[model samples]
Target: MRPEPGFLATYLEPAQAARAVAALRARGQRDVRVAAPAPFPELMAALRAPPSFVGWITFPGALLGLTGGLLLTILTSLTWAEVTGGKPVVSLPPFIVITFELTVLVGSLANLLALVIGARRGLRRGHFAQGGPFTRDRIGIFCAGVDPAVERLLRESGAEEVTRVP
Candidate 1:
């Protein structure tokens, strides 16, 4: 199994995949990539992935939107100074709608932007198959650099199939 520098190990079960990853890390193999059909929290924990920063981006974006909405409505009202029937010109009730709308708009946009950026960055990390069962019912573990020991470890950890990357 320790045949080349790059190899793909396919696993049919999530627990086996997680164990493989944990074993790789324990053996000091840092360049490990995993592909799965769905999000596996236990696998992620085994990989020791950091918490996502999308919420950090979203919070600032939402704050900016809220401030912008408030300022836009308040400033336009002040600039025009259009006093209607009995309501005050710079009213708070009417501005609520616009403020809420902008907050949601910017927050969601920021969240989308963060995910796109993260995905693109992740794509550069390792070799991935263009088409594979990993996208359906299997999990793939891609090791950027491998040795015979790594390959044996993968099979021992329950890799059903192992192949050279290219």
Candidate 2:
């Protein structure tokens, strides 16, 4: 058995890649892949991918942290029945620091985990992340199909070089 060839179009600037992505999408080529040294908001918009949902993870993590902190302080206070310095038991002031700390900690941890999973998932998709020109200078649009229309579209969109991969 033989592996199917791939097609790649390299761009000097992100705008060129964005143009290629939009053209590809217009042509119903949803498997287009983009690789660049840094993030490009224009390219992302051209891809028309959904907005990130990492914030959803962080919000729930923060809520859980807040609840855990409140439970820890309140339950412990209730269990011990400690009263000191004429201050009421289960006071809210001292719990604020721990609650805030846990909220920040859990929220950030969840955000970090989400980002890592998202990156890995992106790699599993059509995205290319090879080191070299792709990492330091150029952006590439890759697809598994070797259709000439895709190649022509890429070239018309200002690709610097279009090549076929084995």
Highest lDDT, which number?
1
Model 1 lDDT tens row, 69-157? 99999999999998998899888898999999999999889889888888887766455656868779999898866488888898889
Say what the RMSD of model 1 is: 3.3
Tell me the tens digit of each residue's lDDT in model 2 across 1-166: 3545678889998987898898888888877778888889898889897789889888998888888888888889899998989898988999988888888888888889889888887766453545548877899888778788888888888988988875
Off by over 4 Å in 2: 1-5, 126-129
lDDT of 1: 0.86
**Can you tell me which runs of candidate 1 are displaced by over 4 Å?**
1-4
Would you list the clashing residue pairs of candidate 2?
A: none
The TM-score of candidate 2 is: 0.89
Worst 10 residues of 1 by lDDT: 1-10
